[model samples]
Target chain A: MCCESDQPSLTQAGHRRGQIQLLAALSAIVLVWCGLLPALGRTTVLRQRIAFLEARGVNPSAKFFTEQEAGWRNAAEVERQLQEHPQAFWALPWRHR
Target chain B: MSQQSRQVSDDSLAMIAAGLMLAVSLCCTALGSTGGGGAAEAAASAWQNPLSALLKLPKSWESNPFAEVSGWLPGVVGSQLLLGAALVVGMLICRVRTGEFLLPFLKVFLLSVLAYVLAEQKVVKYYGLEYALWALLIGLLISNTVGLSGRLRPAVRTELYMKTGLVLLGAEVLFGKLLALGLPGICVSWVVTPVVLIVTFWFGQRVLKIESAALNMVISADMSVCGVSAAIATAAACRAKKEELTAAVGISLAFTVLMMVVMPPLIQLMGLGPVVGGAWVGGTIDSTGAVGAAGAMLGAEAEKVAVTIKMIQNMLIGVVAFGVAVYWVTYVERTEGTRPDISEIWRRFPRFILGFLGASVLISLLYENLSDGAGFVKAVVDGGTKTMRSWCFCLAFVSIGLETDLRTLSRFLRGGKPLVLYVCGQALNLLLSLLMSLLMFEVVFPEAADVLRK
Candidate 1:
């Protein structure tokens, strides 16, 4: 009779353990999604900057520090652009600057 | 198989796989197809998909939408998943039980993915907050807050990730590039750096009386060599406690930020031209990112000089890692009575340094022999292996955070000796780098500076 009574409780415990495992997996997935927030925001900014550069007739691909019109000379200039429109500045490749 | 044997077997397999990947990449680079344009386009396109943009999914996903859709991406995330799966298979092959490892490995993957995304954020990127720092911070937050569950234990393989990353980093260190700055560049980076490293380490040991010699070495290397990367290499070689590595890294990063912002303006005020300023900033700054950012502030000439000097200094990573490994095996862990045999030293030596050296030499040979091989090397190694290396480093930092207790770090900070060591080392580094830069670039090798200016 004792063994018979323990069966239902044992099943319940097993079910609970499964639930915790599932919850842990779900928690991890959620954390991953939330972490993407910053990258998503940055990407959006990069896209806008590319579009702005295209409109300005500036070849974003030109050798960095070579062209006088579009080329950035120093970090101060880059910082100024970033301050004004961060997406554009960050969108430019490291070599392009 | 026993757990110890299983671990050894798994590590050996990882080493082989890493070697194979490097060999194949080098061959691909030699075939006149480094895939630079394609890779860059793929990288730029990666920012298009919201999920990938946020997650920084592998470049493989850009070519195959199915991979992204199925969530089986192949670059950084894929490589880590594959590594985990391979370990599981290795266990199965060895006839070991693997039931407990699955959930913990999954947890590690999730955390690493999250850390990668955080690192990709604009503000973080602007500030040069690397994935390593973010991974460590996030892991610390999770462990200290919710606490690491029992299931997470299997996944926190910090040392494994670090060793693997170091091996991959070896491929990126091309000795040929050291000649770009010529002899003057060598003097500033090679000559002064070791002098500062030895002197600072001695100061820490004799004067500061720092308790952990490993910690002192790590700080000295980080300050005198290449910042965070140097700290990681030296700490691994000397078998530093996780908390000690953390303390050293924290100090380095904090000062890196301050120096990056403050140094450029100070250089301007000191009436240093772009060439001199660039060389000084590049040689002295703790972090490479900071070096570039600081040099960029001065102008393009400064930026060029800065990168060249930093590249020369980066060549020292292999030398420093090997030297530390040898020092540790010979002096620190010496078995008092008997002469240390070759076999014993080989056993005690960090095998990853061999992998690092092998990768460096192979790539250097390619750069020497092949036409436009530098481009190929940059394309294949930078685009492929370097990305994976970043992930490995991020994962390692995450593991460090998960394994560390806040109290453990706080206890190490009690006397603040490590802090003093870093500050003194950096101060000496600054004074020496300035003197050396002026002597080499301005006084001795002004022609090299002029060439860089043009």
Candidate 2:
């Protein structure tokens, strides 16, 4: 009589274990899908804000410095100086007035 | 059949398999060599033969006595070829003495060093792939049949090599770089790591029902956090089973290779600026070398962001390793009725990591003191350190391959849980990294974005 009573409980425990395994597998799948896929279609609004700050003279953290930034600064400074005085460089070295 | 007869059959079969694999490895090497036809042929013709290269040595009389000794000593020796030979010799000795074939760790290190040198010299364009593939081939042959039949020792050796390599790698991490991304980078790494780890682990256990907790943890960490290096570090700390390590590595390598090839194109297609793209790639990709490559391909800005982000993430490895070790000891081992003493913890702990920390501290101190002189010193140190780390890792990988049999790995797949866990965790890493990069880099650091655009 006792053995007969325990059979259902034993089967239920086994079922619960199987369910836990299934849930773990599903969570893993969900996590991967979330990580790899892009969150939205286009650049987030935050990216645009960053671009705006970058256009100004302010520097980002030193770690984030890209070679392109150096190039841009160099070119922009040259163009600005040229615009400031459309005349003569032969007689004197160029400097920002 | 009698037990004696079965044992004999197994041994004979193992020998036959080993012989076949060795032949295959040799064939692959020959084919690879021949494939490089023109340049290889030209170089071969112009240079002295391999024998001459072996025979030629720097004149001992030309250098200071100290320098000569330094040059002669195997520990300080710089020659990749010599290192390879030493590794082979070491493995052979171990095999003879123990009656077990262990994967030749030293040989892999040598080959990796060779690859790095070749790449630095522009002799080969893809150093990581070349070395990884080579190590894989050689490692596969040895581990599968010929090497040590016993499991525990090889696993221990591999862990030792990895930890030591990590410690040496510490010197290369500049504290200044860590401060570069400043608080944002730190926050991202700190926040993202636990979330990913917890979620992945939960999935591995509750959902996937992976029987081995160690394997589950490794896969979760590898995919959600840093990849093979992270996996190895964590696995060693936890004293994970050999099968678990193999699975983690397999997953990491597969994803890393795919990401390396696909990421640059994806960035371009999305029209994301270099900075955003690079940060995303760095955060998502498994391998540091692959991250750098992908970043470089994208643009200069991309390279900077990718490398910076990756380095920041890499720095977290030490902390993660420590945590894993603690967890294993305090929670897992303790629950199992094994009260681990502090000494046992120290014994199980990968000591070489201390070396890595020491190297980092030393380098940082030198940099602070030298300032202007730091550049030249950094270059030399960087070159040497990178060479060493690459070699060590390659050796470890080769050892792994040598010990592993494809059949064994396939048998592991019967559970089908690891594959699911890997894919899920990696996917999560990719998305989380992208979200964080977009928000932190794009929104928070607009100046960086503008600079990248220009």
Candidate 3:
């Protein structure tokens, strides 16, 4: 008889579960960013590793092939173009000059 | 309409969007461009293989548009409009609900920004971690935890965003640069990479008997080629699942951090001179920046050689993607004994690959012809497209993460074939690259080593 009664208890289960999951997910992110990452960053191993890379002039942060190589020269070239060409693709309204 | 027919149309429409974007970029690039020395710079940088020639990036994040937001507001607005047309068009055309797409687009844009900021953070960037992983983590967090509501579901168009990103990636594949390093660089990168990739894949399929062919291919390409970029291009070409791509990228990044740190010191200990050491590092390391950084540890010469060889290897992204697309259509999906019909192959083929190739060919032609074409092309790529591609990819990863079931990834990991395949493939790449670098630099054409000094 208890099982037979459609008391909407089962109907609300999905929503209740979703809410709980959301809270857990949020807590995980907060813990990682606020607690875990800060703690990890403060470690000697990570700091020394970062220092090692810096000394070698290696950019460990580069996600793609063209990224490190695509620096400085591009900006210089663009500045040159804006100075030379009356109308350049990059010659928009925003220039430091 | 059948799902198959719908997919064919979907791919075709993506190509159209890419084509439209390319056409607009060419118009902008073609209109006002006149200078010399850019090609001279190109010629010199060819052997050095300056990637700045291929793609544009800010000097640093601090000076880039993101940092100096107000100062560069107009330029930012213009570039975004110019390059983001394909992304916006992609979503709009997929299923027209002009009003509906806006919120979803905003959601995706915000997510991408968040991922980008997280990746760009000093500590994260310094550790060799990247935006794609952050985006994926964020996505997985949302999906496995709170989950996507109906309103958010519309923006999780992984294929569309990924396809557009692939096309942008294609534009950067300047095949003409492959010969810049001569035969030795070609041998180290082109010959060794494909051989290692093929052997690794066969080993996975025949020896290990991995269940998922797509997973095998992603790991192989990511190991052989340039990490996440190769994984992405391959995943799109073969239409691998989100979980498969996520796994492929995760493995690639983990290995890359290990390889980048260990390779330089190992190379130095081995007494492989800058040319050979740099070539070996360039040929082996998964990520581009790490290659440069690793190469620099040897010397300035080694750094140049390393970056140049990697740039040459980077061209393989297009060829391998196209080849994989063809192979998948022809053999992988074939049922038992029957040959795939031409029309069937056409239907099954990933047409976005065609967009990818088209962008490559178009941009290469422009770079070749104009007096100041190199400058003009550089302007186009550097000004906006790279950022757009990065954003699109970040969005795709986020979408993938949202859709993923963590259990599936854990299940795949349980097999352990992927780890074996990566180890074996990387081992082969190391052996062959070392042999080729030594042979080309020391034995056959010793003079090729001199080019590095020049």
TM-score of each: 0.75, 0.59, 0.82
Q: Per-prediction interface RMSD?
A: 16.1, 20.2, 13.0
In candidate 2, what are the lDDT values of residues B1-454, reduced to their tens digit?
A: 4533332332233222222222232233333333322454444221111221221212212112234443333432443443334334434533423233234333344434433222221111222333444455445543333343244333324443454455545655555545445444554566776788889898888988888788888888777566766876777667675556777777776777688778899989989878779878878777665666667678666776676666667666766777877777666666466687887766444444454455566566755664232332233332244434445555555555645566665655676789888888878877887788787656665544454444
Q: Which ten residues in a row are the worst by lDDT in model 2 chain B?
A: B54-63
How much is B36 displaced in model 1, in angstroms?
A: 12
For each candidate, the alpha-carbon lDDT, in order, equals: 0.66, 0.52, 0.70
Local distance difference test, candidate 1: 0.66
Q: TM-score of each model's B chain? A: 0.86, 0.68, 0.90
Candidate 1 per-residue C-alpha lDDT over B360-408 given as tens digits, one digit per residue, 9 for 90 to 100: 8877887567554545555555445665566667778898887777877
- Weakest 10 consecutive residues, lDDT, candidate 3 chain B? B44-53
Better of 1 and 3 by TM-score: 3
Could you give candidate 3's per-residue lDDT for residues B104-181 as a string of tens digits? 766766676667666754466665788889889888766665566569877777876788778877777776766556
Error of 2 at A20 (Å): 48
Q: Per-prediction DockQ scores?
A: 0.04, 0.02, 0.15
